[model samples]
Target: MRRESETCTYWSELIAYLYGELSADERSEFERHLLACAICREELSGFERTRAFVRTWKARAEEAAVGLPAISLGSAPNQPQWRQALAALREFFALSPAWLRVTSAVATLVVCALAALAVAHAELRVSSEGVAFRTGIFKRPPAQTKAASSEPLYTQEEMERIVAERIAAARAQMLDRIQSEQLATREQAQSMPHPSPAQASAQQPDFEHRVRRSEQAAVALARDDDAPRLSDLLSEISD
Candidate 1:
């Protein structure tokens, strides 16, 4: 009953049906259509024939009988306690330089990891007790700087300039939309050849409202237009 996108082709459904995994209702419907649809019927028949052929070959395959040999397990050579200790020492000295380096690196890494875990545990305890880790050996992130503060990434002025540009773009867009709406309202009023008494009275309020709105918008735009340029301010500060 799910509505599907027309753009999504039915290849996935066809694959499911080919695997004999379609729901009974869907399968029955598909089969009923297959009786009249030659292409689907032929494809289904071909798949069925391939499956039968594969099963036939499987049935004829002779399974190889495996015989495991009686494996004689070897025992370790018995050595005296002193000889065993000496052999161990010999083996340690026989290790290649590469293996020695690998062992040393692994040991160093494990020691470092354990030290980090211990330090982190102590730091977490301090944090849980409301004590800042930054006061001692650990350090916290730097405090937030002022918006007007200088940074290596960008001068305070540059960031301000970008923000100002964005704000100006948004204001311009909003102004355009308001103007277009006002123009549409004027067109609508002019299109009407005549107005009734009640309609004329209604028009008066709308006209007054529009005039007030226009004046407010004009004032807002004028102020925004004369606002200090962010880029210029930054340039002056940089100098």
Candidate 2:
């Protein structure tokens, strides 16, 4: 009986008592209370386990869909591939994960549509002017949803943070590439120490010629910078 009480209090009410987020007292209470309540203890254990399973379900779903490049939304007659896929997903030979995404996407679409229908349904019950103030789905410039223009914007700090994160990632990648190239260069220099003794004597004379060529190329680049269109550089170079 003591063991069962300990599990119950910990299991069933512990999560919900989190009250969306747990209060200090609620948290303290749950921690202490679970020790005595077996049912709640089991419920909490089950809930945590269930949450982990749900997380795995999503990860698995993403993996299955990863290789599926976005299907052509081209003038292909079937534009509602999502809807069709949603309907037919269960039959696909793909693993259970893809099916889960299809199910989730379908449910999300349905919920959005139903919510829209409900709003429109309510609005229609009371006959108002032709222009409903609802969010417009049309991009036709004349058909404006002016309310959207008034929507609250993200703060400047949020935008800066996002940009900073991107810049940091790029900098990190640049550093890695620089380090890798530097390592490769050191290794190459070490491996050939002085090239082969026979080739070293033959190639030593060509070093000055290559240096002169590189200097000429630099002068040519400086000259072209003033005259060349970007498109000229992109012209296909046939080997």
Candidate 3:
């Protein structure tokens, strides 16, 4: 039992010894100990058996690995080569400098924006008036400056008829404007407070009497002026 306990205590050393990983002196000492102890001898034999089993397992695993092709976890077997290339490119870019990546992204965005603007700026319009250009970057085209022809497109009689029609339309518009103004004036007058009938009558009489008094005064002043009268002429002729 004591020998058994001692052998158990050297369990880690026994594993190292089975792998031949110990120093020469330590291996020799352990071998001498094994010779003197039956329990140690049995334990070393068990370790040797376990090492043989592990070697057999490792050999079998290597053979199996050799028979099968290597499969990468990063890429699928059936995926296209372009996808793999793109993935490699992405990885390269990811490993590139931060400034370079940012500059490329910004340059791409700016180019796209400028291209959109340019496309929008290339518009042209045609109409009966003339050709016109519409753009976001350039100024608007000037209005058509060509003067109308002096000669009328229509005959004289037709021109007169058109002129008459325009005059009639203008007259109608003027009449409509006058009527609207009169109606607005009438509405304003109706909105105002008016004097009572008796107050209006009283005011009229007073105003008429004042007018008559002013007329009589004007006649007296005219008679007193230095103009010859008909009675004076007759008296002068008799004298």
RMSD per candidate (Å) reads 37.0, 36.5, 28.7
The 10-residue segment of model 3 with minimum total lDDT is 69-78
Question: CA lDDT of 27 in candidate 1?
Answer: 85
Order of candidate numbers by TM-score, starting with the best: 1, 3, 2
Is candidate 1 or 2 superior in TM-score? 1
- TM-score for candidate 2, please give it: 0.24
lDDT of each: 0.61, 0.54, 0.61
Superposed Cα deviation of residue 131, candidate 1 (Å): 31
Q: TM-score for all predictions?
A: 0.32, 0.24, 0.25
lDDT of 3 by residue, 1-239 (tens): 12344436565577678779999999998888777767667766655544444444444456667996434333133444445445545644543346668999999999997788687775768999999866766676789899989975776556557656765576567556655655665576568567799876766675566556555655654454455644455446646
The residue-level lDDT of candidate 2 at 37 comes to 62
Off by over 4 Å in 3: 1-3, 6-12, 68-239
Best by TM-score: 1
Worst 10 residues of 1 by lDDT: 1-10
- Tens-place lDDT digits, model 2, residues 111-214: 99879867554333335555554543542467654565654365445555665676557656755665565566557545876878898888666664555555
lDDT of 1 by residue, 19-130 (tens): 9899999888777766676655554565554454443333333221234432322322244434544554444333223456578779999999778767665443455558
